[model samples]
Target: MEAMYAFFMDTAGMDEMAAHITVAVIMATIMFIVMALCAIIFTWMERKVAGFLQSRYGPMRTGRWHGWAQAVADMLKILGKEDIIPAEADKPYFIFAPLLVLLGSLLAWAAIPWAPGFVAADLDLGLFYIFAVTSLVVLGILMAGWASNNKWALYGAARGAAQMVSYEIPLLLATIPVVLYTGSLNTQDIVIAQQGGVLNWFVFRDPFLFIAFWMYFIASIAETNRGPFDMPETESELVAGYHTEYTGMRFAFFFLAEYANLFLVSMIAVMVFLGGWWSPIPGLDFAPAACFVVKGVLMVFLNMWVRWTLPRVRVDQLMHLCWKVMIPVTLVCVVGAGIWMMASGAVG
Candidate 1:
């Protein structure tokens, strides 16, 4: 971005501060546009995948080919709907919840490395920053539920808060091995550590890290409230969960945040375990950003597939799986990774 500002200053003969502000705004606008497009595309893809899995056509009439414009139509319809707030709802929190959720997701993009030179912020503590920012989603969920003044919404919000908090432990634990091996918290450093080829990727480094990859993926699914672990917003039980009382563009904000989180977690998994922008071939490094996107999209596809294929678990069952199953397994993986690192003299 400094380079961008410099170029603008040189070519356009602008002041230093003006060039800096212009570059910052341009980068932010680009990020927002990219995120919005991804959300729109995934909305259509989700329905199409659901239809295929259910032995039916999805969005047949919305667009020319496979309803490519269905997402656009849905966005238009949502924008046209009335924005309604509950009569007894807490106005301030109710209005701010979705914005918080969206803000959290967008902020995460700043630290993510899409390609070699393509990170927005590149903070030394990128991993920690991601965890801190994304945790706000849970706060937004709880706020939305409580402010709605509905029992069902409150129940959903409580479940979401508990589930996200529970899963976050294993999720953080799963990344411990990557940090252990790399000895750095920066995301770009993590990705650089995994470069070389497929074998260099952390997932293939050892059995424990491989298991940790799956552990992270599972915890991420739960963290994002995807189905099979989507007890937070279980339609059969909680109506529409935390956002039950939201509508129109406000509701769309939540929807966009959900899909954005889906992509966010997938991208994190790719960067930490699957070699972020590294090409699968040993020396065939071309289109690094494309590689990252393809890998991230595949992970997102897996999330969507699992969403449509599985049934939501009971709340007690969800808690049991998190506490009794995932946490213990990830703890073992963390220990095993440490031992492997020591035994191999990989740690200094």
Candidate 2:
């Protein structure tokens, strides 16, 4: 943020406050564009990936080249569709729900450092701020479900709320090991701690941190409401889940937010566990932001791969994995990481 502020002030001849505001607006716009692009690209990739997994061609017609323009066409179609609100629905909450969900996902990007000195807000509590803001999606989900006044929407919302709330525990627990090793919650600091090479990445630093990474990855999929744990929007059961009554652009906001959160979680994994923006080979760093994006893209691919390969788990099974299996395993990881650090004299 300081780097951006200085650049703006020096080049644009702006006062401190003006430069600050300009930088904020630019960063926000960049984040929005990135999220929008992710939705477009990932949706297309999702189809192609599913097709490959299912042994068929996906989206080969829309743009005449394997449907490269399919997502764009879908976006345009959705943009022109009529905005419909259920006659019996609570109008105010229904209207506000998608915006709230989108806002939740967008707000977290401010604290994410794309590369050294390139963050929008380099706060000491970057990770904590991310966790805090992203939780707003739950409120948005509840609003969408209850506001729709549909039983399926309501049930989906209930399950989503339960699933997200339950999984957050292990998710946070899993990252605690990283926090312990880095001794800071600042996202950039965490990345800096693992800067040497692939071997120094937290996942390879200690056996326990490695376990925590997978736990974090699994919980992230659940937190994003991806398949195998997509209890909130089970199409076969909930008809479209919490957004069943949403239409047109209003529904698009929810879709946009989902992909935004998807990339956000993947980037978080990259930053926390995969050595954000740093090339795996030591002292050969170049194109830091590109490195970050490539690593994040790989994480996103892993997520999509898992989504298509696994069957959605039952609601009870989801809860069992979170509470019974993941929670205990992550707890062990936290303890083991701390002890390992002490034994190695990394900390007192």
Candidate 3:
């Protein structure tokens, strides 16, 4: 951001404030477009992956090569559909809920460190900010369910609120090891600390950090409402869950936000545990941003694979896993990581 601001002010002869604002808008626009494109590509990849796992072709007719245009076609269809509202619904909250959900996901991208010095918001507490903003998703989900006045929607919302809030504890706890190691909440600092090679990545640095990685991964899956942990949208039980009454573009916003959040969490995994923008093989770190993105895509593929392969857990089981199992395990990881750091003289 500072680099961009300098470029605008120096090259375009703009005032400092004007340059700052322009750079901010540009970064935000770029983040939104990148997220949209990820949604499209990931939607296609997800179908193909599910097909491969299930021994069938998926969307082979929608595009010439491999149904590359299927997601685009769906977007076009959604664009042409009418926006419907329930007559009895609370109009304001109903209208605003999806937007709020999407905004929460989109805003987190601002803190993502795409490459060295390339973040939109390079705050000292980027990771904390990401967690804080993403909790807004629960609020939006609750509003969506309550405003729609549908029993299934309300039930799903309540489940979603409980599940997300429960999982957040372990998610933040798992990340604490990384923060302690790096001594900074800046995403870039975490990446920089893992620069030596694959083994230097936090996931491989110690047994406890390795454990922490999986803990973070599991908590993130639940946080994003992905399958096996997807209690909120269990079709058999909730009939489309919190968004049951939504239609057309409003529904599309929810869909887009789901995929966006999916990629966001996967990207965070890459950034925190897999060494963002750094090649695993030493001395081969060209195309840093592309390397970062490819790692993120692979993480997303892993997420889809897990989703396709696993059955949804019962609600009680989900809570048990989060509160009883993952929370305790992650607490152990945090303590163990601190002990390892001290014993190895990595910290005092």
Candidate 4:
């Protein structure tokens, strides 16, 4: 941001403070716009994918080919609906929950490097910052559930809190290999470390890291409360779960935050394992940002595919998968990665 302010100062002859403010606002606006667009597009894509998977046309009449404007129409409907608070609900916490979740998702964009020299804030602890910021979403979910003053909501929130906290361990552990290999917590540095070719990517660096990648991806799906692990919002049992009492734009915020988090975790996976913005061909400097976006989109699509393909697991099964399966596997991977790094003399 300081560099951006300097560029503005040089080009526009603006004062330092004004340049700083301008850069901050511009970056914030861009991030918000990008997230909003992703939510809109993904919602449409989700419907289309669900339609094809279930053998029926999704939205075929709302806009141009295949009803592209269906998402827009849905958004307008959500916006126009009445915002209702349940009579027994804690109004303050209930209203603030969605904003908190949305804020957590948006804050994750700060350190994500879209391309070389393109990031909102290139902090030294970028990876750590992302993990820390995103954890807040769990709290928001719990708040939403508890504040609703409904037994179902409270049960969903309890399950969600447990699931998120459980999965987060493996998720953080899985990233340890990348941090150890790159020897820097900076996200751009991690990408730069994989600059040679596809083989140079962290996922290909070692067998253990490869396993770690899958583990992280699985944990991420659970962390985000997607299907097969979506006990928090198990519609069949929980009656819409945590946000059951939320209506209108308030409910829309949670919807938007979920999609935003889907993209967030996918982008993190790309950056940590898939070579990020680096071209597959060595020394080739084609559109790096485009490459990054493509990787992220593929990851997001994978999430959607799994969500539709799998049935939600029971709450006990979900907990057992995390503690008894994922955690143990990830721990072994972390230990193996450490030993491998030392044996290969890659650690300094």
Best by lDDT: 2
Candidate 3 per-residue C-alpha lDDT over 123-163 given as tens digits, one digit per residue, 9 for 90 to 100: 89999999999999999999999999999999999999999
Task: Please report, in order, the local distance difference test score of every candidate based on alpha carbons.
Answer: 0.92, 0.93, 0.92, 0.92
Q: TM-scores for all candidates?
A: 0.96, 0.98, 0.98, 0.96
Instruction: State the lDDT of candidate 2 residue by residue for 1-348, as single tens digits.
Output: 676777889987999989988988999999999999999999999999999988999999998889999999999999999999999999999999999999999999888889898898889999999999998999999999999999999999999999999999999999999999999999899999989899999999999999999999999999999997898999998998998999999999999999999999999999999999899999978888999999999999999999999999999889989999999999999999999999999894
Alpha carbon deviation, residue 154, candidate 3 (Å): 0.7
A best-first ranking of the candidates according to their TM-score comes to 3, 2, 4, 1
lDDT of 1 at 294: 95
Where does candidate 3 have its weakest 10-residue lDDT segment?
A: 1-10
Tens digit of per-residue lDDT, candidate 4, span 1-348: 556877899988999888878887899899999998999999999999888888999999999899999999999999999999999999999999999999999999888999998888889999999999998999999999999999999998999999999899999999998999999999999999999999999999999999999999999999899987899988998998898899999999999999999999999999999999998888875899999999999999899888899888888888888899988998899899999999999998
lDDT of 1 by residue, 1-348 (tens): 557766899989999889867876787788888889999999998998899989998888877998899899999999999999999999999999999999889899878999986788779999989999998899999999999999999999999999999999999999988998999999999999998999999999999999999999999999999998988888887899999999999999999999989999999999999999999887888899999999999999999899899887888898898899989999999889999999998987
The prediction achieving the highest TM-score against the true structure is: 3
Please report, as a residue range, the 10-residue window in candidate 2 with the lowest summed lDDT: 1-10
Q: What is the lDDT of candidate 1?
A: 0.92
Which pairs of residues collide in model 4?
none
Residue runs of model 4 more than 4 Å from their true location after superposition: 1-3, 13-18
Give the count of colliding residue pairs in each prediction: 0, 0, 0, 0
Worst 10 residues of 4 by lDDT: 1-10
As for TM-score, the candidate ahead, 2 or 4, is 2
